[model samples]
Target chain A: MEEISKSPVSDVPTLADVAARAGVSTATVSRCLNTPDRVTEKTLKTVMDAVNHLGYAPNYSARALAAGRTNMIGAIIPTMENAIFARGIQAFQEELQKNGCTLLVASSSYRQDLEEEQIRTLTARGADALLLIGYQRDPQIYEFLKKRKIPAVLTWASEPSQNFLSVGFDNRKAMKELATDVIGKGHRTIGCISADTATNDRARERVEGIWAAMRDAGLEPDTLQVVETAYSIENGEAAFQQLMSGANPPTAVMCGNDVLAVGALRAAADLGLKVPDDVAITGFDNIELAFVAPVPLTTVHVPHRRMGQLAARALIEALHGRSPESVELPTEVRHRNTL
Target chain B: MEEISKSPVSDVPTLADVAARAGVSTATVSRCLNTPDRVTEKTLKTVMDAVNHLGYAPNYSARALAAGRTNMIGAIIPTMENAIFARGIQAFQEELQKNGCTLLVASSSYRQDLEEEQIRTLTARGADALLLIGYQRDPQIYEFLKKRKIPAVLTWASEPSQNFLSVGFDNRKAMKELATDVIGKGHRTIGCISADTATNDRARERVEGIWAAMRDAGLEPDTLQVVETAYSIENGEAAFQQLMSGANPPTAVMCGNDVLAVGALRAAADLGLKVPDDVAITGFDNIELAFVAPVPLTTVHVPHRRMGQLAARALIEALHGRSPESVELPTEVRHRNTL
Candidate 1:
């Protein structure tokens, strides 16, 4: 299938080949290729035609070998189907580009095995540095990075005690504060729609925070009806329905993220439940969906763009042989109409 | 800054180094690494620890030099801030993965120069195939791809006469059909919110479609007030405000896509204007934002996931030396309350 590219590497057409084909000096061809204004229009056209005829492309791989660095950074995110990681990665790429680095993104669909495979694939492909999401991976991954002398920075979640360089907010604290506020609103019975907590540290911490908040509010943590599911609006709706179907339904619903809350709202409409009046709702991650939803969502806001920019800087500094420190960004609970 | 990676090419540790450190043969080291079950647990531990100590990652570059094929595909999209391109790209990657190929993604921020740069960068990185958006680009790019013998298929837009392989719905015809429907609702004066058409062929075609529909409806095409801007909710809101500020504003507003339509709905709420009652609105690319907005949006549903899958197959087939024909998908206008 890939046979055409199987031509002997030595057979690759060079600039000299193009110059010889066009009957022009290598210097004229180079000038026409890089800075066309130095060459006459006729010379430019002749050089370009020869270039096309020869199918000559400057080999970055060839130069990359010479430079000993490709200046490409790889980012392994969980998924690309939602806006959760979109804004952060955008800012991360922007900062990297400003420093003459390119980003290669590979989504693992939140699977650890796939993530581990990509970690090796990107390394094998020559990524100078990596931007990872969270720090709950097997210690062998850290040892691999350590042995390879590759620098990697974590994002989305933070651990103060760990020495790993990271830029993130306390997901547990943020959700806990939101849950406390929901409880403060006089809703004793609360249901939670959460992403599977086992593989997700962020989801786990957020769930813990809610339990802590429930305890602080003098409510039985077991009384908090929890529905575990994947992160999707459809899943959120189903979870909300399941939680509400219980004989003793909660007075309010708290979701793991804005996507889930939006789904819960959709389910509310489908089930003929009025938001806040029939059941109050809250979410985490103050994404645009939080605001654009039919009922503006009360959620916790994480500085996604800033976190991405800072994470890029940390990775770049680490690549430059600097010991960049971990950063813990704060999250604020945004009180909108839903609560 | 990248000097740490400046170690001599020979300094990279080899399998022999790990074997020597672990007091095992190269075969034992290889088996311990690839098929650990064949080795004793103690041997596995010693080999892994030594592997970590030496940081011996299988050098893909060394093997890639001999293989002449990397089996990597690159997809360059416009932006990551929204969901418009998210689903399509996710599907594209899934199809490529199922075919034993890996996908590398780079965002161009919708800039032509940046896209062109990424095209070169991804190509230089040995992408066997490429999935690009739109058919409108300098023929020089096609020549370069031809010269490199790289197979690339276009998505999102198609032109039959051009002979460029693509998988897309007709943006002009789809939007024209929607405009015809809006016009059929007895709105003579219609205004449009569109993306800047100078650089984007999709936006230009959709605008042209609206004008064509206006003409067919016996209305002066020039009477269609158009606001050209970037594609963002904030930009959409501002453009909607500008278009509606006119003394004799059109009764209906047609947007280039659902993002803008959702923003227009937000603006409608802010301006205390009733949707459809005061001003009817329509959009293209019925993204999730369309359905989740405070007011449900009616939009043309482009087969994004299907297009992604088909485009991946076409590029993969081309990579396999097959002349896959371009497949044009169909679009449908989803009827909802806003229209």
Candidate 2:
């Protein structure tokens, strides 16, 4: 190990030192470090070589203990890397901001264990209230939040039989309506591209809705085929290919969300299948992608932004001792060109 | 306001109370609040009515001081409502997670003041390191980070002249090459849809690259038609319309990123303009949207996941008393059908 012969504060090789060694400006040194793409390859190498030669590293251990109580809220979502939850969470954050509250977000990547860990993590880190998605987590988790006296608001679904306060909509009914619409269009053999229905109640309810629609249409729900995968354009494409390549391909494909539908559309195009004419497609959550999709998707439009704003308002009101009524917003079916 | 006359914990009507009154399970009460979409309209109304009638409010004032030093990293992104930064940030969080560090994220909504405030807030909240975007923020900010011994990594751009450690590609070069290729296709008139170049160095450099390509081709850069706006599909569409409807519309359009380019493509289609035949278009950041756009887009591909992973490694290494060299990744231009 290198010897610590000099004072900790003064001896560390600064970016300026690297720049001086490389014959560049402090700004250039930073650009080389922070925005090397703006610099020439030659300049980039020169600065990087200088940095390596000088041993320049910025000290980043800035964590400190808070002095006292602060106005902060915490939220845990399935994932932060997609548009499905983006608008809603953004609206949630904005509403919190209006009430002078800061939102701390953690993504679970759709893993239940991870979600529980993050919930505890945020709580340990002193989050005042927690905003969570969906309602299918273990009952023990709810008991834990209650035990900790951490009021939580659930999003993306509403269960009138649950103990938790939720500001959400009916996923099962929304999907049922969409499925009914597809059935009305004379679709018989319906195929579904759904996310994991086992752990995710939302996905499960969506499938249930489709089954309900099928039963209503006097069709045997058991005859319907489904391919369960993660929510992604690539997965959706693969699922579509799997369904269409089968011996008895579906006349219409119903996706759990718009992301999957977009993928299904891409798959259809690659297979040279015209949407609505060759095989119709439907998606849930009329995200911006739905309208701009290869074929504008016929899907359910969830009020993401409104749901977020309402969730925030509900939590804020609760914090102020007002029991905001459990609000259940509505979803609409947007009939686009796809079906 | 009602007088506080009862014990804090015992008086609060839990979801169980609402459920009991509504003749449902505590789970149903939670579902009504969190996932109304999962419950029936009738059950949702009944639970909500009970909640309002019982004046049941969950207590959320759980803010407390952190026990001590902990492993945590903080990131402040421009916005959370889009896919542009999602992949990169997720990758960053994953890397941090592998090293036993949790990531806390804040969205700044692309406002400088908000970002500055969040930077301070995260710092005050005791983040071990910071992952930030771009290279154009105030120099004083870097000084503040250094003064506090806060290790920071700048993403999205690699500034060869800055003091901050960055893991990014050359935005200017990536876009310039795309523009050069567009120009080589025998199109003299060009149009650019860019974000605010003044504050966003990445956007500014992207425009500069196009201008540089124009100059190299012996074209007057001043003659290039330009439209500046926020980054969104709607704005991109409107900007495209403005560009095409002008007295001298460009034969080719270059967008700052894939999102804007998709919008432009939509506009082109709506106006009955066939892509490439009537007007060629290009974009930066070959996001998933680029490939799925009405026209598969020709754009520059930035290694988003890799950038995020490398940024995380840099900060973690710095945290561990290791001086890691700044990293600058490469970008490629994909010439799809749009160009």
Candidate 3:
């Protein structure tokens, strides 16, 4: 076995090498590799033995080029530094695996140009379908996918678009509901600490939702102080401090997500302010941290896992030439003690 | 321009089509794509125009198979549900990208069989090198990598293996230092909540380190209560509750990492216990959550990002036929309010 496997190492094994070792034609080897059931049992055994001996691995990209499918699904997410997309992407990968598809993931550092490049790269590597975060890319990318006949589904934000498929929640509605609930508690002056909304539709929609709620409550939405910063606990703390520095500090602070909310809670503790008493705090995205925070955070709960599973199913249907229905999972408010 | 780009789309564009469109031989187009400086300015311009019109992307796998280098590094992590490996892997990827390489990631859910399958899949997909979490796979895997001449580096815990390369911190040493510090703080009765150590060397080493510290402090190490569970905030809370339910609860609860430490803190809050006054708590891996926790956690600070960056550089050197030296980044105990 060692001798058979120890032949002079080439860069990688070619079909011809396997054929030579098995004493068969390269066509027979290729047939055995792709459609083993169609080949005779003895021939299959002979080819496989030679294959194992040579440590031969099928060139996935080469095969993808020939068949136009790599049995692989690719996703480009904004960032992996937090638990924001962790649960959802895990579910997405599990669902894809159940369908005999592997997932290739790349992070874009929340940059649009990098996401565009990742899309092209995944497609070039022969991803049969793609799972994108939002439908906010340049129109040429959609045209490019159309030209290549690759299907893609947008997730995380459910904004209806005639040109794309989506599986997510209405971020604006979720945030608006939370904001309305916050207002019902009789807190007039409010402050917002949001993720940088320039490249993130969810963050923008969420801020808009808060504005709509404030406007509905007879509060001047334009007067509401807002701080846009990168999503980090430290940033959230800094933003909270900035909001509190005003002469008449807002009675409440609403954050874009639970991570920032946790930061605000930490800051509240550090500054010796009582939560829901001295100041109220609310967050979007009820990730684990929301419940585990010292002061359980009041936040919006998005169905992340379900959306991921649905996105996988939708992309698989599209791959099979069936247009899967776009889905919008519901979100709700988890009224914890922080509010 | 639309007409020029609207040629009958095959599954993907081929060099032959680009060559025909440029009215040049395939070799000239290949040269233009691979070594543009070798092509004349006019020829390069014509070839690039044809390439653009056809939306051509070179098949990376095919190129890799021929050259034995994909310029792609693959890492198989235990899971992505936590922040444990996120910061490190992100830094590793950024470093790899700087060296003109792309990263392919897969999570194995800490199952050895699944990890082995991922290793095979990544190699089949033409990963030039692999970044594994630990040196804990079947011996056959090491042999398989050696047979294929695929370079690999173990990370997270620096346990030297003559057969492999490692770039990490000494888990046992770091944990022991923390345990010693807790002991010095005058806590005799100690409890531990750790991630399942059966499959994780890092967790196992930390637990052993705590035991070593207890024995060295003239305390009965075997009397220390321990709970092994999944690394989650809720799990940590439950584990801490379990330890406190014992006939004699420990004066201090030591966690394998900060996530568990946070959970332990939450449990203490719910149980109406004051940290340090009623019970002290210490954690490993000073992730951002440690500092932000209501009672900032005392924990071991591992240089996650630097380890990741160093791992990438070492692997790249190994790939280039240079046997890079293994690095052991320092770890220190961070004294905080928890202890």
Candidate 4:
């Protein structure tokens, strides 16, 4: 058998090679790469041609040294696959871009330790500020922020004790209002689908809000059904199915968020249960999907975009040495077909 | 009324002041802030107190000079509000984190000009490499990346002419296969709900692929009706309503993506039409919602996580001076209840 001819491996060039090819000083070449706008068009084109021809790659470290700020802001959220923080973070990024900032986002997946590690990485990478989801975290994390003097903003949950600028809706109060609406619908037997409360303060507060509202209405906590699960449509569907399959199924199911509510709706349909007539379903965080569902979802609408904008503004202001106050935006329930 | 006494504004202390307060050299304070691992636990506490008391913020520009690399990567996607890029980008970020790289993400919101601006901003912020969605962008962007010698990989679409490395699926071929399946279902009249094809090469390719498949099946090009709109459920629903309300409504609707397909399904339900019975529906990019839809959507499944991982691996290899070849992953049709 004839031996196969192997393809030759191509080489990637370095910044030094580009500088040599362009017949310019390394600093000039670095300047051209770091601030193209500062370089003349003719020199810029020449340097660019040499780079493309040689397949040159700039050294990021050296470039970072020359530039004062890394165009990065670190944002630690619970999850991105879920819509809860996704939209708000997206909005936050948009606002950041308007101010010429890039957002470095990471999902802690709801682990406090992982979140702290992410913060360290972000700081190492020279992130100027941080946008964290909730105020609840290890005291060491707060101490680290204070020690580093990094401007950090909290979102999704607001805690007065933290003394950090926060842009969020009152999670406990929002849930309480949502539960009141559910009870007003004459749902004495209420079922709940919440995120794991032990780790997620937001989920804990939401469930507590519901329980508090039910108790005030003269309904015992034991009468309310509760299932703690992750914030996922599939999990929501499973939780709803489990609630319905129980000996005493709830007449109304109040979900921790819209995602769970959507799953609950799907599960209810799968079980041949008509919403409103057979089992009323309610969701929180009135995400866009709530409006688009087969039966419009009755849920609490959070001004997520506005919150993101405010958070960005506050962080930017803090960066400029202006002390910005924390903001608590409002949330209201939208009555729809499901409820 | 007594004039409100303004809280005395403390002049923000400099790094020198923080160093003096902590009884450490400026270099020590810098080391403590930059690389805490190098500082003793006792000294770190002292530096932290000084930092918090003085409200001292590190001058990022000075710090950037000392650290050689920014340890940041910039990823520009079309939009985060849309789930199409969500899972893939999330996977990309997860993989990058393992390599000790922070991802700076920006959304262009589907605007070419915005994309260019984001590219410039990311480059200026010292992104070692860039991750871009789709190959179709202003040539200037390519030139800019080349000029800056920023290693960038184009995703979401595969094209050979582009010099940039790519890890993506063949949108045209995938759509052609999906269209073939639609034609095989014995449906002569086909309608399409696509995002604005004018600017989106992916959208255009999908529509053209369907046209090619239909033509190959001995159907006239005019038989393939199309409605262009944004990639949103609400917009998708509107397009489906328009298509169904037409004089010669299609017996089947093929959507450019699953989000649009979901909308079409909802619109069909609203119009009292059953899926696959009255009108079959097919979609592209089988997202999570595709399987969970009331009628499981017949669609094309793109290996999003794999693509993300492959992209990150390629970028890292390139960064390490290895010339990685362009990769094109495959896509397949997922037949479900919709068709």
How would you encode candidate 4's per-residue C-alpha lDDT over B81-184 as one tens digit per residue? Answer: 76768788888888888876778889989888888777867766667688998888777668767655567888888865847799998888899898888889
Cα lDDT tens digits for candidate 3, A160-271: 5655799998888899999998899998899999987887898999999999998999988887788999888889899999899888688999999999988888888889
DockQ measured for candidate 1? 0.43
Q: Which candidate is the best by lDDT?
A: 1
| Candidate order (lDDT) | 1, 3, 2, 4
Q: What count of clashes does model 4 give?
A: 3
Give one digit per residue, the lDDT tens place, for model 1 in A148-221.
76789889999756778888988888888998899999999989998888898888899899999999989999
TM-score for chain A, prediction 3: 0.88
Interface RMSD of 2: 11.7
lDDT score, candidate 2, position A114: 91
Report how far residue A157 has shifted in candidate 2, in Å: 0.8
The weakest ten consecutive residues by lDDT in model 3 chain A span A1-10
Please rank every candidate by TM-score, starting with the best.
1, 3, 4, 2
On a 0 to 1 DockQ scale, where is model 3?
Answer: 0.30
Candidate number with the higher DockQ (1 or 2): 1
Writing each residue's lDDT as its tens digit, candidate 1 over B85-127 gives 8789878877876775677777888788888877876777777
Candidate 3 local Cα displacement, residue A194, angstroms? 1.8
Give me the displacement of residue A48 in model 3, in angstroms: 8.1
Over 4 Å off in model 2, which ranges?
A1-69, B1-68
- Stretches of candidate 4 above 4 Å error? A1-71, A245-247, B1-68, B245-247
Fold similarity of candidate 1's chain A to the true chain A, as a TM-score: 0.87
Residue B105 lDDT, candidate 2, scale 0-100: 78
CAPRI-style quality class for the chain A–B interface of candidate 3: acceptable
